[model samples]
Target: MIPISVVVVVLGGWSVLYLADTILKSFNSLKNSYENWLALHGLSIAPFHLRWQTSFFNRVFYKFTERSFKEIFQKFSVGMVFGVIAMFGSMILLAKTLMQTLAQMMEEAPSVQSDHVLQVVSSSSRIFTSRSILLSLKHTQVVVPGINLPVSQLAYFFLAILISGVIHEIGHGVAAIREQVRFNGFGMFIFVVYPGAFVDLLTTHLQLISPVQQLRIFCAG
Candidate 1:
């Protein structure tokens, strides 16, 4: 029987290809507003155009949180302090975990396997043990043909990224609107095989804002 690792690698490769194809196909149907916006920015990449929509999720944020983001600066005044605290705490945890992982890897004895085999084994061990960086780390063997990641773990990994990305973008979006900064729209970014999200802001308007206001907008994310 084939090893479970081999099966996972095969399935992960197929699913990623399928997802990329699906997203590319969907981009062909984007509305004219989004198309115009992309054109204005000289970012008219085929199969990766902006696709705008009226989302209730954001509507709720502006509605309950700060009355359409015009009040975002005031609403998030105290929240910025909390956001900074959270960011520092996260950084500290990441540093500690990474240091510990490195120390452990250094303490590990040399493997009986060949050099190539030993390198792969060591990378896989570190990825499985550390929770700090998620799946984007150099050591992770998620989507590559020779790398193996179980289907269940892959699903969880993608879900975590999606949730985190949405929350992050919302923080920036609402804050931008509250500061009276223009929000172009939100969109997905397909960086190689990895998927991510972002909020579009008018760079000129953003630069015109006060330094403290600009810092708050950035820290919201």
Candidate 2:
């Protein structure tokens, strides 16, 4: 989870940027200012009928990177397979835990006091053991000021998230394009206060694809 200070900073920045964007839409002068700024940098924004926003920086960088992206995917395909397996294992574990919890609850009956006690104890023991093992493997570090994480680590955290998000989305886009999937567009969004990226793929077409292809597309992210 993000620390409070980091959360505040993100919210504050989004507020400021969103206000500017709104103002740009309403005022011709401001819109020209935005256009001029982008023109100076050889960049542009393509607004869609969605809440998410996206920008194109340089076509040259995109073309070069597009070619390399597929190559990188091919090289890491084996690692990706392992990642998908691990992801599925985690889902199975979660589902099993939930099913066991529900079974324990349904088994509880007032008339069968002795049986209820045994079942509750057994279920509680299993849940606690599984939860403890999961928690033991989990760890977090704070980066926000006044948190467990030091302020100095903020840059590292920011870069980590930015790079991770970009790479993850790139995988989805690359796989979709490689499989000849019809793509609408891609963009970033600030849902409530959290920032994330998304790649738009047609669900109908996605359903038509093979399960192996679908798995590749999802696990790429």
Candidate 3:
């Protein structure tokens, strides 16, 4: 049975979101004006997502990049190397963790079988225990509100993701600008529950740059 608190929280959240969307759509002139403003800034919006873009950060990128060529190259070169190392390290760690978890599950398989037999003998206790374990495993494998994570913590999770994304894109933008690549714009978006940021650069400019400079730009994020 679903908890009453969980039901209330879900309904409240949906109601708030619906009300906000309705208010925005109900004001025709306001909605049109907002859309026009977003368009002017190279932004766009769709259901469950909003993209805001602007070239206002170009000056900051340029300022950061304005340094001796050798110094800039050395800094980004170090970043590129460390980024490669971290990428491989993370892959290895993830693989190792997955192997360990699989081994542990295998070891627990007999216990699960035992539980099944016990369920047939003492139906109530064993059935409840097995169900609880299955539910916990399900929630562990997937993010489920009120199961894996509380509804109240969702806001902080999203906020942290947004901040990390913004910083990541900023790094790419700065690195591209330093490599003499054209920094077209920066943008952010929220797609459903996930938040992300991106930097736009001229493809032609990227193609013209040396491979080392390209590596720096790619690894900066």
Candidate 4:
């Protein structure tokens, strides 16, 4: 049987999608008018995603990017260094977890007895034991409203995510403009429950830039 929480989540997601589609359709009586309006406003809507993009922030990006070459280089250089360090640290932690899991599996494999085959089989369904990588993961919980998290806190959570996403996109836009790449626009979207923001840069301009400049743009976010 499906859990009540699972059912509620599914129904809620479906309802949100339906409502978004309905609101979009109600904007214009004719399909062409709807399409034209969306195009004119830089709006795009799908079943589970809504994006509104515009070039209004291009000037702001340019202003922010108008820094001394030394300052810009130093900022991105520090960011790149920290990004690399974080990447390597995560890799090392994952590798350690895998090694621990494998070691535990091997230790347990030899203990399986022929007489207790059924018991061993049942337990073997879990490849990673509680003492392994799963030990940490098992305690991690998802922040579901009315469940693990209070419904009132949900707004704060979403707001934090939106702020972080906007800052991340702003960083990318500034880096792109600093690199002399064409900053097209900025957009934000909500996909199901996750909120994200993006900076649109011309693909041709990005491709034409030097590898170091590309690295700065990519790592800016």
Which predicted model would earn the best TM-score? 4
Taking all chains together, each candidate's TM-score versus the true structure is 0.54, 0.51, 0.66, 0.69
lDDT of each: 0.62, 0.60, 0.73, 0.74
Q: Roughly what TM-score does model 4 have, to 2 decimal places?
A: 0.69
The alpha-carbon lDDT assigned to residue 195 of candidate 2 equals 43
Top lDDT prediction, candidate number: 4
Model 3, position 138, has a per-residue lDDT of: 28
Better model by TM-score: candidate 2 vs candidate 4: 4
For candidate 1, give the lDDT of residue 35: 52
Please provide, for model 1 over 21-139, each residue's C-alpha lDDT reduced to its tens digit, 9 standing for 90 to 100: 55654686655655576556534342323233333355555564465444555557777788778889988677656655544454464544334444554687764443333322435
Clashes of 1: 2
Model 2, 117-216: lDDT tens per residue? 5556567666543433333423322234336556667567656775778678866766766555766566665444334567777788889888877776
Better of 1 and 3 by TM-score: 3
Candidate 3 stretches with Cα past 4 Å from truth are 1-35, 67-71, 112-147
Which pairs clash (backbone N, Cα, C closer than 3 Å) in model 4? none
Clashes of each: 2, 1, 0, 0
List ranges where model 1 is wrong by over 4 Å.
Answer: 1-75, 110-149
Sort by TM-score, top down from the best = 4, 3, 1, 2
- Candidate 4 weakest ten by summed lDDT: 133-142
RMSD of 3: 8.6
